[model samples]
Target: MHKLDTKLIQLCKKGNEVAQMQVYDKYAQAMFTIACRYLINEEDAKDAMQEGFLKAFVNMDSYKPDATFGAWLKRIIINQCLDVLKKRKIEFSNDEVENLKVVDDDNWDFDNSISKQNILNAIEQLNEKHKIVVQLYLVEGYDHEEISEILEIPIKTSRTHLRRGKLKLQELLKVKYNEARY
Candidate 1:
């Protein structure tokens, strides 16, 4: 945690509303973006972000200084988003999601050359299960074990979702890139 974050957290723990607002202002936009990745609706994302901030303030005692404030805030925001998704009946079937071992296409290579927008668009086009796993893995940098814990699935299911999601992404990007080349 930075000096500013430590100061803000200390003040927040002491029930300082201004300090809480300052912390919210500093992290809201980034946290909102994280929420938006999981929620298709802007309003839902905004609500989740708001809920996350409220939770953070309410649970100020749990804020350990070992991790960066942003990371801690992000986990809260992601959980809020996931909660919204769950309320919307986003189902994760163990039997259906298991063992989809799509062979990764090593020949299809994309680096910084591809536009971020293109990749994001492709990700948006993915199914909910695959998109969530992909975003959590590729964007949020969660491992299969952590993902399994978060999504409440077997570790193998998380791996299957990631593999299938990546393969689908590769297929989507291939078309877009090929179109650009020709």
Candidate 2:
């Protein structure tokens, strides 16, 4: 059952603790999933979620009810995850990236045998830039234009990192499979 966003916003604005908890409970699972999509590790996702909630609660006054509460929270969580990734300083730059293409290779399929957890684990192995690009492009369904604005990177750089990151992710998955068989 979904609670009305307007009600949640009203209650939150009043500094009601119950309202805050209600908001958290309502969106916690989805928010955690969103965080995981970016961070790719359960622990990191958990951390991002907690930190995001803290930030959201502290700045609850800034929330204009015009937008859904969940959307507001999602933005904070995503930004928090990106900040942590930046602290790690994972590089994502190359002149050769100009030539990397990212056509829809829909043929690349992961059988059900490859668990979602396995795929996410493999993604976590990526550098921060690649991880961010892949999450924004493939997972969140953002285009290069939107991605450029979000990550503040050039559009070309975003596409290059995404393509390169995808190729590397596939290689990681294959290596994991081989190791599992050993």
Best by lDDT: 1
Q: For residues 11-92, write the lDDT of model 2, one tens digit per residue.
A: 7888888988988998999999898777767999899899999899889889876766777788899888888876777555
* Shift of residue 131 alpha carbon in model 1, Å: 0.4
Model 2 segments beyond 4 Å from truth? 1-5, 36-47, 58-68, 105-113, 175-182
Cα lDDT for residue 14, candidate 1: 92
Q: After superposition, how far is residue 40 of candidate 2 from its true place, in Å?
A: 7.1
* 109-180 per-residue lDDT for model 1 (tens digits): 566568888888899999998899889988898888899999888888887777778889989998888888
Which run of 10 residues does model 2 get worst, by summed lDDT? 99-108
TM-score of each: 0.92, 0.72
Cand. 2 Cα-lDDT: 0.79
| Prediction RMSDs, each to the true structure | 2.3, 3.7
Clashes of each: 0, 0
